[model samples]
Target: MTSLWHRRRQPDDVPTPVAVAVSDFCRRAKAAATPTEVREALALLADEDDFRVRSLTDTEPERSPLGPFAVVDILRGTAPELASQRQGCGYYEVVRELARVREEKAPPAPAPTGLTFAAPPAAPSPSSETPPEGSTARAGKSARQAAETLQSRIAPRRREPLAETEPYEAEESVSFKRALPKPRGRFTQVAAPKASYQTLLHVEGKGILESALAQNEHRFALLKSLSEQYNGAKGELGLPDLEGALQRHELMDRLTSRERQGLLAAYTEQRGAAGRVAWSLGLSPSELQRLVSMLQLQAEVEGVRERFQREALGTRHLTQRLDLLGRDKYLADLGIKKRFTEMLRKEMEDLARGELPDAVDLPGLCLAIARKHGAPQELVLRALERLGLSEGLRKQLLAHSNHSSP
Candidate 1:
C-alpha cells in the first residue's frame, strides 16, 4: 500500500451539475475547428441560468484546464472581434445567439410610407418665350440705365496717381562695439580635482558603504548596536517563536529577488541548518522542501546544473531524506503493514551508519523508534534483520525479544 505521505490530495468540493455540463461544453469547444462552432457549443448553454456556469467562463486556465476563457483564447486567433466581444461580456455569446434566434422568428419590418409631392412648375425657357410688343425696347433701355449707374458709382472712387515724389535716400550706417571688462589684478587658482576618492571595494560594496555613511554618524552607531542586539535576540529564540516572529513581520514578502537568492545561499552554507534557515526566512519546513524540489525540477527541465552547487544539491537531498523521517507521527498512524515495512527499511538504512549504544536495550530502542514513527515493532525488527543490522546488536535484540516474550 502507498503511504499517506505519497498520496495526492483530492479537492474538497464536488463539482455541481451545471459546472460539469459547462466543463463538458468547454471540452467540446476546445476540439471545435472554428469560433462559430465553439460559439454554437456555447449557445447550448444560453438558457442555463445557473451562476456556476457563468463563473466557469472566467475561471483561470490553470484551475479549469478546458474553461471557457481558454476556449475563447483559442478562438481569438481566428475570430478576434468575436473573441473580444465575448470577453468583454460573459453572457455576450449567449445573448447574441438568443438575439439571432429572436430576429429569425420575428415578423419583417413594415414598408416605409410612400407619400408623393408635386414638382414645382418648370421656369419658362428664354428661347421658348415670345417677347411682348416693344418688350425688346424696354429691356434695352433697362440695360442702358444699369450701365450708366455702374459708371457713376465708379467715377468718384478713381483718383489720378501722385504727380511727383521725393527721391530715395539711404540712412548713414553707425557701428558700436562691446567694451570688455577689466581683469582683476589677482587670479584664483582652480583646485586640483581632489584625487577621486580611491577605494578597493566593487561598485555594489561601495554603494553599501556609502549608504551606511550617508546616515547621521550617531544614528549609524546606534544602528550597529541595534543590529547586534537583534542578532542576540534571534539566536535566543526557539524555532517556533522565531518562526512566529518572522510571520508577524511578513519578512518573506519584504525580501527582494536578490535577497531571496542570498537567503538560498545562506541555506546552502550549512547542511544541518536547512530547517533553521527555512524558519528564519518565514518558511515552513514543508514549504522549504517544496521549494527545493521545484529548484531541482527547474534545473532538470532547463538542462542547467551549474545554477545549484554540488554542496547545495547534497544538502537539499539530505534535507529531503531527513524530512521523511521528521514527518508528523500522525501521518503513519494508519499503520498499514506494507507502508510500515517500507518505512522500517528506510529507518534501518539511516541507522546503519551510526553507532549503537551497548548500554541500551536494542529491541526496546528499535521498538521505540518504530512506535514514534507509528510503525509496528515486528516490521522494524524484520527490516533490521534483512538489512544486516550489526551481528552483536542483532543477537542482543533477539535475546531481549525472547526474554521479554515470556
Candidate 2:
C-alpha cells in the first residue's frame, strides 16, 4: 500500500457544473455572428440591473473582442489571468479555441441528413512528404495549435473531485478565455487650448476694471467740485467752521457757560427745518443745503474709490485668491489647514473649462472638490445645497458619496 504522505487521488475526467456553465457562456458569446445575436448574448450574460458586470465593455464598444473578454472575465474569476498567459496568440484565436474546446467537451448531436464528420487524419512524420497548404495535415496542425492555446487557460495542476459526481471540487476548471488588452480607437478627450483659459481670465478682468475705473473717475470729479464749492461758500458767508470748532472740549464748555448766562443761542433750539435754520443764520437756504449735500457725497466717494482699487487687482491675483479661498474652505471643513494650492488650481480649471457638466455631475463636482481637499461628507452635501442643485441630483450625489465612503 502507498504511504499516507505519498498517497494521491486521481483527477476527475468529468467537467464540473461551473465549468459547463462558463464554457457554455463563452461558446455562446463566440458563436454570436451578428450584432443582434451579440446583443442578445450580452443581455443574457452581462448583468442587466443593479449588479452590473464591471467589464471592458463598459469602456470599450461591444463590437470589439475586449468587450467580450471583459464579460468572460467577470464570469470566471481567474479567466483574465489565464488568458493573459497566451502571450503569442491574438484575442480572436483565443476566443475561437474556447468555443472549439466547449464543442469538443459537449455530447455529440445526432447526424442531420444522415451525414457525420470524418475521422481525423494521421499525424505526418518528418520523413513524409510535405502536405499542401489546405491538406488534412495542415488542418490537424491548426487544431493542435488551438488545443495548446486552450490548455493555457486551464488550471496547472490536476485536481481531484470533492465527490465522485462533483468534478470541480478541487479547482474551478471551467474558466473562460484570457482578458484582452484594451481596444484601440476609443474616443479620447482633446485637451482644451491653454490660451483659452488665459483669454477668459483676461476678458473678465478687463470688463470689471474698466467699469470700476469709469465710476471712480466720475465720483472723484464730483467730490472735487463739491469740495471747492463748499470752501468758497464758507469764505463768502463768513461762517465759522462750526464742525471743526466743535471738535474741541473747550468750545463745548464755553458754549455751556454762555447758554447759562443767556448770552448765546443754541442751533439745536432752532430745529424747525433747514429753511428756518438758514434764515436764523442769515444764510441762503440753497448754500446751506449744498454744504449738507457735499458731506453726504464725500461718504460715497470713499467707498467707490475702494471699489476701484479692488477692481484694479490683477486677474491672475484674483484667480489665485478665489482658488485659495475654495481650497481653504474645503480643507477647513475637514479641520485641516495644510497648503494644496496647486491641486486646487487644477480643480478650479476643470470647473471653469466645463469638465464637470452641470446637468449630470454637479454633485460629482462638489464631492470631487471635497474629496481632493479631504472634506467631510456633510460639508460636500452642504456645498451642493449652496450651489442650488436640483433635489434629484442632490440625492444621487449623496447616494454616490455614501457608497464611495470608506
Cα RMSDs of all predictions?
A: 30.1, 31.6
Report the C-alpha lDDT of model 2 over 1-406, residue by residue, as the tens digit: 1111110111132222323333334443333232222232233232332134433323322211233334443444535434433322455345544543553565654533432333345677678587666776677887777666655545254453333232122334565899867655655545443222122123353443233334422222223323332332233212233223222223334433332222112123331233444465444656545543543433433343344334322234333344334443333422222334343344445542352433245545655555655554334444334334436554665676676669
Question: Which clashing pairs does model 2 show?
Answer: 83-178
Candidate 1 colliding pairs: none
Query: What shift in Å separates residue 105 of candidate 2 from its native position after superposition?
Result: 71
Worst 10 residues of 2 by lDDT: 1-10
**lDDT on C-alpha atoms for all candidate structures:** 0.41, 0.38
Worst 10 residues of 1 by lDDT: 1-10
Q: What alpha-carbon RMSD in Å does predicted model 2 have with respect to the real structure?
A: 31.6
- Over all chains combined, what TM-score does candidate 2 have? 0.17
Candidate 2 runs further than 4 Å off: 1-364, 370-383, 390-392, 395-406
lDDT of 1 by residue, 121-163 (tens): 3354588587665766766676667666665555434343223
